[model samples]
Target: MIEELAHDPQSGAPLSSVKNYPGPEVGEGLADVQTQAYRTGVRTPEQHPLVEWSGTREGTLTNGELVSAQRGLLGYFRRTHRNVRDDPDPSMDSTAALALKRLKAEAPRALDSFVWYALAERLAAKGYWAAWMLDHVIARCPHPTQRVDGEVVGRCGSRLKFRPGVGKLEGVCAKCPHEHGAVDEALVEYIGDIYRASFDEEMEARLL
Candidate 1:
């Protein structure tokens, strides 16, 4: 599977797609597993580039803070990638795999895999045991998110952002009347779509 993805004609091979870097060395030391995991998120660094902000910092009101927060999460993924590459480990791969698998099993009806993958990658970066334990905590939390922050505000109220069902998970966001922010419903939904896509990309890049 890795080899086939490595040489996709449209993408010009995974190595070239990601700048012909040949990815991390995977072997008895679990180099291959780690390589596969990172590639699972971004087919090419050019398309994803590790991090991007959906909203600007110059906004007023708490606009799309969730979107910005989500972008920060994306950066976290890139950071994790670099960290894992520098200090490659097989257990990390195993831990990420477990995170995804467990999420899949628990979130059987999840509309997307991006969030699940992100959860796994985030946990694995810390350590497999840590990730595994975090996985259990996430599973227990119905919403799985603690809070949402605005990423953009523009002229349209505060563009608040948070994980879907974030307000439901804890009494945090729900305590306030403006949990979803003051942005247009359409715009909020659109941002949700983007996160959904990001989640997919993240999972694809790290899945082992």
Candidate 2:
């Protein structure tokens, strides 16, 4: 996804109006740091000294280049989170893991907002959304586990509920008995709008 966005070649003209979008504001401190990094083509040593550019690059990077870098960082976080979630290994002290831990500790709210933004983008693109079914929920399989080739692999006759958000299954399936039926169309559109506005803000902050 980062690569695709980097090579889009669209000149980013369509995002011009993103300047006017009214929504959540980026943190002043973070915005200042980002702008400085974009202008100088150098991340602060104390803040992000571990960041290493993949290619032979020199001099200050343009706004587009900085945006690409930001996207890359976000993508790295997404992959690291998935890895840590799916396979827990306490001894594995990888750079991604350390960075994730630092982000969680230092900027928990920003991390949460970014996660939501990423989820909204994915759900909107896939034409599906999730909703909370019950105030208190339990994970239950209606049937016993099925063995595949002598290994218990799958479950049969299970009415699996879709889970949204992070950390825990905070929400239930949209197709539950209550008929939540996906997120509202307006909300989904607004999510997209927020994403665009945020991206534009990040990319255009130096100008401001």
- Write one digit per residue (lDDT tens) for candidate 1, span 1-208: 1232121211111223333233444223545645555444323322233344232321211111111222333343343455446665556544554444444344333322234334555464555433432222111111222334753212222212344453552212222325333223443353344345434546777885
* lDDT against the true structure, each candidate: 0.34, 0.32
Residue 57's lDDT within candidate 2 is 34
Judge candidate 2 at residue 5 and give its lDDT: 22
Off by over 4 Å in 2: 1-53, 57-66, 69-74, 82-84, 88-189, 193-208
Query: lDDT tens string, model 2, 41-156?
Result: 32111112223333323222223321223333444333333433565333322433333343434323232223334333433333432121111122222222456688433322
Steric clashes per prediction: 26, 0
lDDT at 124, model 2: 38
TM-score between candidate 1 and the true structure: 0.25
